[model samples]
Target: MKPDTSTIDIRAMALLIILCASWGLNQVAIKAAVADIPPVLQAGIRSMGATCLMLVWMTIKKKSLLEKDGTLLWGLICGLLFSAEFVLIYWGLEFTNASRSTIFLNTSPFVVALGAHLFIRAEYLSRIQIIGMVLAFAGILVAFHESLNLPDSGMIKGDIMLMGAAVFWGATTVVIKASPLAKVYPGKVLLYQLGVSAVILPVASIFLGEPPVQALTPLVISSLIYQTVWVAFFTYVTWFWLIRTYPVSRLAPFTFLTPLFGVLAGSWLLGETVTIYLLCALAMVGAGIYLVNRR
Candidate 1:
């Protein structure tokens, strides 16, 4: 039987917020890591590390490591989508400013909403949800309009790549909603993606042929660890858990927070510029999210 949304509990919300916060901080972590580690290599290593940990955990828990009930095909498909999405994101980051990347990347929610509306029976967005989505999109614009407008900024390339990445992520989620894999454990879902990414990223990194690890500073190492643990392990698992427990549509709107925090942190920590437009965008996004989810 399909799970009822009305039965969602407090633990789900707590998990959601924690995951969102980690994803928010993830942009900064990626930026910091990419400064020293080659972007592809960084992605590869992080995925490999996460995969190892997840596999170990799954083993201890005695979850089916070898895909019971013909789920391996679906898992492999999801993993391919997962791998492609991050590859684009990591490479895009090298060309783009983190704050602008976050703003543009937040476009994924809209794509997901649209996809759900078109494809899924259970995931409809009400008029209020639509309004909230527009508000959040507008908020992103407000938050990054100045940076976006600046001439000679490399942001154009990065923003494009991130936008593409968002679409990829959106499509992946839609597939998840449609696939039989939804019936499987969330841990299985994550493992498929991480394990595939582990193999794909490393091979791709080799072809990209990054220079030997030149200077692995403490900052870089810390950032990589943060991405591997908090972003990869904690946040991804939390996200899968939320998908299992809550209404996907209601919770997806909250993901606007990821980019909101990303923009703020980039400005504060990395000395990225803050502009009036961004402040206005942030206000609109917060208000929109509040209105949409207030029920």
Candidate 2:
């Protein structure tokens, strides 16, 4: 593992951009594919497929999934949180545009930061961090301002669901960081979540009465491949590697680019309207994320 450093070289920056773009495009792919495969079912399939791929990679690298000492309990907790987060994300996408959902989903950092501050003594928040949190919340309000004015909107429901997803995502992070799972290899930690989610999400889909696949078009197949290979497997591994090699504070601010890419990709691929309000809100959220991650 590379020693943590404040400097982000050109290569690292380029890789970060690629990672963000891949993640941003993932939302668009999910939105397009969910029409054919019910969102929950689609998520389950992707998780299972990714788990298989992860197993192969781990085998090739001679990494032991069982190396984590006493992590089973925390691993299961993280897995459940991961499963819940994706369920809400996929379900929320069914009711709202990808751009809007992506914006709300990015709020996970704010949630994670807050949780860390409250639970981890080492992560106590400074005044600037508090201000960043307030700004982030303000941005969320701005993004949903119109929807809030109109009662009982599908967009409102979708936004709320996405927010719920962000909460779960943040909670998962806290669990991993606070528990014995943090002592394990990143791949092992990921395997626990992927392996457990593979089972949980499918069962949840069945219980939720998600319908069978409507059709398996080329686009749907391609989206599934992308989600399984690129988004869930490769990018995740790359992200873990990057964080291990660099200062997380340096790498984290670049994540704000993800929602920007998400918004642009949604407009380009799905023809979602980019309202002025959304742009203003994105700016606020981006600034807040930068502040929160700043040293």
Candidate 3:
């Protein structure tokens, strides 16, 4: 059965905002955990933990884990993309600050919108959408204004990886839109992707000489719990619910707030400096979101 496409409710908007905000703060948590744990291992545990929880959820809901339909192939492809996205993001964090990472990560919108236009005929971008995309891109640049000025900080490489991660994320979005897995329940889709990522990341960590237990600490555990439970499972489920329940176009613009929240959370939690550039970037992104949402 297809989800109802009707009015966007206030609760959905609130949930979207909360999800974005939680995700924004989640970057800081992951960053903090990295100091006490290897990035890859941390990512692995987060995925594994979330996967386990999702499995329990599936069991409770009587949802089948195995897909009999052709959507299984799409699910695997989507999972591979998801795994690669986090692999880049987690590893890139080792080379860059959370704020800079957030900036580069926001580029996903551009990539996704472009991919959508090319592959999914349903998602044609209007002039306003194009302009909004550009503005959001500018906002990302603004968010990293200070870092851009420092050419000596080895930011070039980190920025590249972060940008690559964003591309992968965009590719995943395209895959989702085009793949038959789109017909599956979001929870089941997430479970499979997380399960795949959980398996892939840990093996990769081992191959990279990063043992799972070597990074285990109290801080690491707490961060993993938070990342798995709140960031991965809860936020994702809530966002999916909103998308399934509300007018997708009306709610889509709120996604731009995530990196803004990331910057703010990074500052508050990690004591990262928030500069005028970030403020300007926030304005630009907010305006871009408004434009994108305007019918």
Candidate 4:
């Protein structure tokens, strides 16, 4: 039997960077639509739509959607965590700016690093790698220095929610890494998340009294398409493949770069300001990614 990959190679690195960029831009899309659709409902819509697309694609590919894999339990857990992450993120954005959201949301890697060290065999982090994770997070703070100081009264609550989402995000990755889901088809793994969230988010949205859709403007429509097609479906499929094919600990830290890309995408797409902090933060993030991946 082939041993699992223990490091990030060139192709995985490139794919991770692309996933980060896609995720960064996805945040802006979420923010763009939240004003028109209630946050939880919007997430529900994204998941619901992505689930449809995945269903069709898997059908075309003749992939089994309901195979009796031993991964059922873990898959459901991942879905719940995935649902929670989205619910927290969109709901939190209602109370916080994207800058602060990025800062808190990207803390997921620390959870992955710690969890993988304890549970996953042969995935321990050296001291330098731990520093790399911290450095990458520091880059996120620097990237959003202004947002960190924003004086919104609800900012604390929003930040706490975002932090909770990060934990769920990390825990989901660790669960997949340590469970039977790691050995399943990537599309199936993503289906677990998309499918479960598909049901849960919408039901919760109803319980929360969130409107299914408020405005349905072009921006909202485009945002939903971007999220469902690209972020939720494509990139997530790639993300699952990556975690299964490589070390989850090595892959998770690159998410630290997501908010940096979010900041830049915000500047390009939303006219948010850019500053010297981004450049310095980029350098630190680069260094951090390197240190963690060092042989």
Candidate 5:
């Protein structure tokens, strides 16, 4: 079937739903595996595996990796930002429930929308978008209000770290869109991220005193494989392709489903408690995302 030029077709919508589900399930997988492998170390290993897989895919597709693209500097920057983002995510997951972290991480869109307004003249946010951003920020506050009041709270720390990761994630998006990296092949764009993180994360894991090998249980191994293949490789590539083929404004709203799925998956798979605050925050953030992405 021919691709729709300006609208989301049934196939695209179905794929988007599937992609969101995979992403949500990924958080549960990480939570399950982190007991056997330290969070940063687990992330490092998964990135390393993903890097190799990306290389293999590139080879199969006959994609050139050594092209003298003027985007190398931007690629490296993106890699660093990408690495930092995941580092925070994996570490924060240690202290907070995966459901909570996912909610905070979904704030990246607001960050991106605001940053775009400031830097990209053509991408200014409307008044409705501004209200949406405020609502989302309020949701974050609602989610963290109690945790923040307690002294030396790990939950607060985790929430802050996840929020920082969301910022980095958004910044990475802005960089890719603004820099020459936008002109590079999407596969190579991903390769740069995975390759750089492959090196940086392992070293960071070592320095941070994370062991190279923990108890490699069946669950751990399965989680690692799922993350490497599904989350990092397939889902990410699909997202990049969607960005290329669809109106991002239309596709962006569907992202709200991800955190909802994340919360549900975490509660179901990990037996995490879903507090009222969390549900309230989810509702606000989900509504905000819709408004922010509305055209």
Candidate 6:
């Protein structure tokens, strides 16, 4: 429970698995609804809904929403980075398969691991961990190779955009670890992100000339609700807690599992392609993550 701990206990592992599973499926949820709702508009609405939920949860907990804390500047910076991440992700999903998007986006751990090493004095990667990072990243390179060679050029574009989002996400983690936001309430940290993105994304949707609402099928609405309530609001709060409670380097390895779950979810739900190459990449990434965690 202490902050900056080097090891992950059983409770953290269990919650992390659950988080990865939900996140993996989250890509599928976005894709499922993409046909009915435009991507940026969908993301905007999800952020708005999740922001409302964040407000209510904080209010019920007697947390002050308007505290004049020093975190405002860093918090807004985090929010802007968070906004950029989702904008790219939702837009990327339009061009690539959910499985591919997941594979590329989860590369944030590399970004986090390296950034933490450079910025946070308490967090440094060991030689084994560095090796683990390379192996895991090699897996990503394998999948990325397939993307570039695909006849569909749009897939390459989407994959690159998702990778860009990974940088933003990784930067967000580093900022939270290195800045004043680390001392603030986790929900409020999330609130800053959700609130800022709620306004920016909808405006983005409008500025981009995306229609407000094209179709509202039951499944699409359910997907939006699930994204808003569970993935964005609840699980992300838990993620911030984990970040505050554990070493960022130690927590980085576990994210490799997310793409596996996402690939499976995409295969089952959207019938997206899943090649043996991707499976091999998953295996290598798993081994690499294990090495990173090994003492």
> At residue 248, what lDDT does model 6 achieve?
82
Candidate 3 has what TM-score?
0.86
Report the Cα lDDT for candidate 1.
0.76
Taking the tens digit of each residue's C-alpha lDDT, what string does model 5 give over 1-295? 8664466677877888899889879868877887678777777787888889989989999999888989788889989999999888877876786546766787777777766667653656668877876686676656555544442587889989999999998888777766676666788888888989999998888877776676888898899999999998998878767655654444555666666567678788878777798789778867775676555
Assess the local accuracy of residue 215 in candidate 2 as a C-alpha lDDT between 0 and 100.
93
Lowest summed-lDDT stretch of 10 residues in model 6? 142-151
Q: What is the C-alpha lDDT of each candidate?
A: 0.76, 0.76, 0.74, 0.88, 0.76, 0.84
- What's the CA error at residue 102 for candidate 5, in Å? 4.9
Which candidate leads in lDDT?
4
Residue 185's lDDT in candidate 2: 75
Worst 10 residues of 5 by lDDT: 143-152
What are the per-residue Cα lDDT tens digits for candidate 2 across 26-73?
878977887799878888998999999999988998987766389888
Candidate 3: lDDT of 176?
A: 69
Which candidate has the top score in TM-score?
Answer: 4
Per-model TM against the reference: 0.87, 0.82, 0.86, 0.92, 0.81, 0.89
Per-residue lDDT of model 1, residues 198-285, tens digit only: 9998887776666545578999889888888878887887787666556566667678777767766888888977777767877897
Off by over 4 Å in 1: 1-10, 94-99, 150-159, 271-279
Better of 5 and 6 by TM-score: 6
Which residues of candidate 2, in runs, are more than 4 Å off?
Answer: 1-17, 91-107, 136-145, 153-162, 240-257
Residue 139 local lDDT, model 2:
67
Evaluate model 2: give its lDDT.
0.76
lDDT of candidate 3 over 65-178, digit per residue (tens): 765867777778878988888878767766787667777787777777777678764566689877876786688777767655563456677778889988888777677666
| lDDT, residue 247, candidate 4 | 88
lDDT of 2 at 256: 61
- Candidate 6, which segments miss by more than 4 Å at Cα? 1-4, 92-104, 142-145, 150-160, 271-275
Clashes of each: 2, 0, 0, 0, 0, 0
